[model samples]
Target chain A: MSMPENEIREIEAFLFLEARLADESRYDEWEALWTEDALYWVPRRADLDPAKEVSHIYDNRQRIGTRIRQLKSGFRYSQTPASPMRRVLSNIEIAPAGADEYEAGANFMLMELAIQSTRNMNFWGGRTLYRLRRVDGGLRMVVKKILLIDADEPIANLSFLI
Target chain B: MGMQRTIVYDALVHRDRVHGSLYTDPGVFSDEMDRIFHKGWSFVGHTSEVPNIGDFKRRQIGLQPVIITRNPDNEVRLLFNRCTHRGNMICAKESGNTATFVCPYHGWTFGVGGEMRGVPLQNGMGKDFDKSAMGLANVPRMRIYRGFIFASLAAEGPSFDAYLGKARKLLDRACDMSPDGEVDLSAGWLKHRFHANWKMLPENNTDGYHVNVAHASLMRAVNAFSSQAFDEDKGDNSVTRDWGGGHTELDFAARYHQTGRPFQWFGGVPAAKMPDYVARMEQAYGKDLAQQHMIEGPPHAILFPNLFLAELNISFLIPISANEVVQYYTPLLLKGAPEVNARALRQTEGAMGPGSFLLPEDACMAERNQLGLAAQSPEWLDLRRGLEREYMDEKTGLLSSAVSDEITNRSFWKEYLQLMSSFPGAAA
Candidate 1:
């Protein structure tokens, strides 16, 4: 069955709002975007499913909450110099899974600038598969899986949310 | 008679600022290749990687490329990857299993053990061409300690065990965690390159002071979970522990301890199940050792030069250029572990994999450090934390530290200078 246009728009808005929250460093709000049983998954390999394959970031809601709290705490050394990031998300697609659950996909690019230097641009565009359910008449994510194109590539510290 | 300046072998003897050339100089790096990488026992790989006969893996020892293979006899051999006939690379792939390596350049083939097996045009060459003498050049020496393999390019140095010293316990503990007393390289590997000096990473890997500040995002994320699990007083005492040499442990302050933050970060275990896993670990390793492992947290031990042995996995940092480094990361799985346990371990590895939330923070920090250091201004990077408390232990050949000490950096610089100053012949 096709998802209603209004429902699709809600999913798109949720994705845009979530990305904005992360880019703005509003981690607490970003954490709130997920359900209590929500999962944040970034796979290591393109072929591996988050449910079956190992993922780079397979945090439950509790872990995600901790991550947000850590960002809020001033003790985090990597965050001391505050990495500023700008995210461009586009090509949103929404598909229905169940009566209230819908899967959403989008392409995104995150450009980070730190105190030390400029032009340290890291470009990554991936399909984010989100399992969304209508909660309190509003959509909340149950699982957000980010499958990066260069998922297997060695990476530096991924301090910020993508 | 004129007096001469005394030569110091110890890395700690230098008092004031080290020369800037040490960081930017090419000649100094070459010298490091000879004195440190070539002379010392550098980790090649684990024996489990090439468990079966004819299994082989290609690796780099400093700038020299080598192929480590297991022959039909189940003997592991480390040989230069170059073909004997025309210097063409024998094994181009990163890793594989093969009965023999055939050079594409001249079709000269060598056995898995690097023995010259055949030449395409055998009669074309006069009978005097000694095939045995023309076989692939073997690394100077290869040795294994509890399945971890190491190869030295130089013929002489302190034995691998003596060099590892107190750090052997870390390896021992890692291997002993498995019921079978061995660990194997599981699945594939993750490779990344950084536009930074390779030396900086080892120093940073063992640097505990940077954790609270450099990894604030990760710590904060982990800490949020901790705040609910434990009280304030328990969190305050969490500090970095020094394990002599350049090895340092970032002890999750007590508040985070209940959440098993260290295991969550290094072991990649889930926060929810940490308590159970810790209990299981305690039962396996006994209470005392488990306490030592847990309370001390995971030690990001830099085995001098460019190897970091963390609880989660093994990583080798190879200097590709003056300002570029290629890092190879592989997950370490306990041998003979149950499928469920292995799956859990692999899950943990995946959580902290290359695309992991934790790694991006680390990579960003490293890249930023490189960019910051590239500036023209002579800004002094601080290594003074707990400086007053740092003392050289006569027994372990390490600079000891309490919480948040920069002794790991100090020890690294100490070794760095020694490696930089010593000539190739001197190291030999």
Candidate 2:
């Protein structure tokens, strides 16, 4: 069965809002979008086991909070000035996963200026599998699993909220 | 005739400071690659990476591609990844189990041990080709101190023992954490690319002084460290140590031991949470020794040019250029401890890699420092921080001082200066 047009539009809007918060480095507002049981994963390989292998990021809810807090701290030089970022998200596919939940996949290409240090423009593109749920009248992210093009290879500092 | 300016490392490296050009000079970087990484020993992959025969992993020995594979005799081998037929990269995959590495360029197949097994057009060559002799070129020296592998490209220089020297104990300290006296590195590495001099990686990894400055974000965000900020007078016993022959450590053992609590070095993990890990350690070693192991945990040390025993993580840097480096980090998992290993994997993600809380700041600072080196007015970067207070450690008889000392930096420069100055093809 196909997802309703209205439901798809709502999901797309939520994803766009998330991208905007993350792009602008709005830590508090961005953090508010995640549910209590959030799983933020960025894997080195799409099929690797986290129990046996190391990943770029494998943060649970507590770790996600800690990550956001670290970014908010004034002394985070990696994000001191924050990388001036904007991203274009496309090819969004939304599907109903379960009761009051939707699994959405979108491709994003982010242009981030590493102004804090290198000042070189970094291009980051990845496919994100975001799991969202209907909360107390708004949508909250339950998962943000990013699969980067070069996740297994050497990658620059992703201290930003990717 | 125009004058040819010869680079002098002796003039640049001083007792209290070194020239800023050391970070920005391409010639200095080339010299270091030849002298340090090629001629001397550097850490390769661990044996656990390739358990059975035919298992292999790709590695680098100073920009030269090499493969770490297990031979038929179950011995560790370091094979140059170039093909025998033509100069083609033999192994393209990062890691896998393979019967033979077949070069797609010329159709030459090599065994797991890097022996040339077959030629596609055997009759085309005038029958003088010796298959037995035409194997992959092995690195001149290969040593396994515990399961950790290290190799040197140059045929002869220093003995691996002399190269490793007193720093061997650091490996022992890391391996002994497992009940089996083994450290498993089966977990794949997360490569972190940063814009900095290769030397900066080693210096910053164990810098006892930078935690409060560079990593103040993590400290403020979370109650991470044990409030043992580097004031010697504050009864905090952690020290910055120079373990002779360039190896250095920010030893938090004293701080962990002072608490008299097991696993203080491991984020104060309660023994009750890991019942099997605790029980196994006590079973293998005596109760006293195992308890002691728990207190000290793994060593947070830099083993000279490469390799970081970063407490619960293993890291090594691959120098790209004068201003670029790619550092690889993996969780230092124990051999038999499943519960502890699981925690270590998550901990490595939160603390070490590109997306982590702590390391990215260090990367940013290193990159900034490299950029700062471009200003030519101030010729020197000062290494004079705890020079007056440096004293000998009673046990190791090596120099050690407050956690916020330049003992480690000075020690690195001393060894570096010696190698660069005395190198065979140094500038005239």
Name the top TM-score candidate.
2
Taking the tens digit of each residue's C-alpha lDDT, what string does model 2 give over B1-428?
96544688999999899999999998888888989999988898899999998899998988799999998889889999999887899899999998888999889888999888988889987689888998999988999989999988888888899988899899999998999999999899999998999999988887878877888888778875526456666787788999888899998878877778988767778899999999999999989999888988899999988899999999999999999999999999998899899999998998899999888988999999999889997889988998998899898777998888888888888888888888876753
Task: Evaluate fnat for each of the predicted models and list the values in order.
Answer: 0.50, 0.95
User: lDDT for model 1, on a 0 to 1 scale?
Assistant: 0.66
lDDT of 1 by residue, B215-266 (tens): 5455445543333221223344443445544445443434346554344444
Comparing only chain B with the true structure, the TM-scores of all models are: 0.82, 0.96
Q: C-alpha displacement of A138 in model 2, angstroms?
A: 2.4
Can you give the lDDT of residue A29 in candidate 2?
95
Q: Once all C-alphas are superposed, what RMSD does model 2 give against the true structure? A: 1.7
